[model samples]
Target chain A: MKRIMILVLAITTGLGVLAYTTHSAPQADDVKVISITAKKFDFTPGEITVKKGVPVALELTSSDRVHGFSFPDFKLTAKIEPGKVTRVVFTPDKTGEFTFSCNIFCGSGHEEMAGRLIVTD
Target chain B: MKKLVLAITVLLVIALMIGVGVFKLGLVPVNADVPPSGLETRFIPIAVHASVANHAEEQPNPMVPTDENLIAGGEVYTVMCARCHGVPGRGPSVLGASFYPPAPQFTVQPSGYSEGELFWIVKHGIRNTGMPAWGRLLSDQDIWHVVAVLRRLNSLPSAVENSRSKLH
Candidate 1:
């Protein structure tokens, strides 16, 4: 009876350690940071490529006016303010080229504001 | 005594959880209607004017509006602003309708602003909101034209007067 109680305690402690490690493990990969600037209804370097499951940090800013950087598929939107840098972090879950657009109306050319995000396995 | 304390603690935890759940599942009606008023109609424009005045001090004046310049402004607005602000006669377009805070019907809500104030808002743009500044891509004259067109929107023969009554 004494041995059985000790064995049960040991098993519970082992399970606790396993659960803690698994729950606390970092789920994202270290990824390269990309910078994009929106100005006059256009994104500078309007296309970029990355690997699937890799975290991507987007450092965005507006050169002139306020603009919205939105990736609908990723459920992400970052408001880029003039003269201030905003960062958006996400791990690409799928492999494909996704489109990002400026939702803000900058002027007559606002509709032309668009960019591409490419992800590969 | 320990058992009694644990029982009281459990009751307290359950009561707290119920309170939070009730708050999260709000009891307010989703469609509670409220009548529109002059105060409601003027709120955005007033806010916009205040913001423009504040931003104007920080940003440079790159555009100057004039009668001759409005023709250029008209062309730009036709391509861009027409879709949302509408083409003087037609109502705010489909895109404007879908916005969370629907784009103000600029026709009825003509910016009660000086030409310089309009230019500053168009150049610096509003933050977080859907407005974008055109200062970088557009030449000084381009921005002036846009502002000029906005000033003319209220006077356009096609523009309907007192249309604010129709808007929710």
Candidate 2:
């Protein structure tokens, strides 16, 4: 009975360690950095292209008013306030066109604020 | 005695499973989707200011709160902030209503920030929210003036109440 209990504990502990190590391992892909600026309900350079399997680091800023950067498909959103720099990082696993839009209502033309991220193989 | 020990062991395993499940699957509140109202909007700024005051070791603002300075700030607020925050007797703007966290009707109750705290937020702005920092476009004095204006917002002359009748 004692040997059986010891064996069960060893198995559980081994499994837990394996899970932790696998989860903490870094990916093999490279990272690309993209800088974007928001002003007057629009994002400057409204489109970006990145390679699939690469991580993206988005450095964002705002010149006027507060704006929200939202990618609905990715369930990601961040607010860019005037005179502040914000950073968001994500890995694009699939190749597709992802829509990005401003969620904040800055002015009359707020609805037209949009951008696109094209991920390629 | 053997049966009683087996029952206790089963109960302990069940309790451990429940604990693990609760930790893994966060129990979100049922009303998590319900949006906050105008009154609740003030809480963010108040909380932020209090936290900054408690934790941030920064210099306090140097602007003197003269009546002239306040009047200048009021003018700036009327031109810039009044649309969303609203003027006296008017409600928040149409755009303000659609925000996930609705903008506060500053006319009802002025922001609970001290003069210095208000100046810092206006100059540096809040992160991940629709509050813009005026530091780039407006000079330091300009932001300070806006702060002075926000201080006196409760006593300002009433504007025409067009917002009450306007469609959101």
Candidate 3:
């Protein structure tokens, strides 16, 4: 009887741990992927709306010239070269409207080469 | 024939004397502080018009007037152009007003300026004007984006409008 009770307790704890691990383990599928195209002086979809707390993957592709994407608040920067796609994955923990600008010297409009990242609850 | 020649020589001497007098007397308005004369106002337009004759009609704009394109274009314009062209419903621009002819309000379309003409002007810039040669600083695609924005400078999409305000 004692042996059976010990085995049952161990099995119960093992199953609970197993269930917890299965429930909490993060899967690659959790990341929401969004693709954006950048050009000489602009980024398409100049405004990006995303939910806070969700892991976001941004695939930035440039069509005309090289540009740099910099999210100052998050300290995230990525280089977007011409005819190339740059990938950046990040979780937006804060909520509000944050600006992301091009760090590269693109052209006359380079200073205004910016987009809005709106993270909402 | 001798009288005609003598009269022509007198007129030439008078013209030379007047030119020298004007130079010595500081009669010309050399400062930008003073407004341009009536003839200058007319001369600038004629000069700009003559430049248009040099370039051929261009192909159509390849980019559609989608929200994405307009918004992107608006962003570019806001950064590089708004300072001079002036913004809509926002009142007159101090910097633009200081210029000799002053910058045109983008909200108002100049009569008979096609997309090609506008593109050429932006790329090459007008001589003796505040406009700079954007070709040296911007890509052709970028210039086209600005041209797209100019097409809808008055009637802009909400997204673009929002971005424009934010950019300001």
Best by TM-score, which number? 3
Docking level of model 3: incorrect
Ranking, lDDT, top scorer first: 3, 1, 2
Lowest lDDT 10-mer window, candidate 2 chain B? B159-168
TM-scores for the candidates: 0.40, 0.39, 0.56
Candidate 3, residue A65: Cα displacement in angstroms equals 7.8
Residue B99, model 2: Cα distance from true site in angstroms: 2.2
**Candidate 3: lDDT of B152?**
80
Instruction: Report the alpha-carbon TM-score of model 2 versus the true structure.
Output: 0.39
Clashes of 2: 1
**Cα lDDT of model 2 by residue, B33-145, tens digit:** 35765565668757876775774336554666666566556655665677778765565665555555656667776777677767777666777557676543445566776
Instruction: Give, for candidate 3 chain B, the lowest lDDT window spanning 10 residues.
Output: B103-112
Clashing pairs in 3: none
Residue-wise lDDT of candidate 3 within A1-121, one digit each (tens)? 9999999999999999999988986777898888888986778979999999999999999998777787868868888887787999899999999988776556555767788999999
Q: RMSD, model 1, all Cα superposed?
A: 17.6
Cα error, candidate 3, residue A43 (Å): 21
Q: Order the candidates by DockQ, highest first.
A: 1, 3, 2
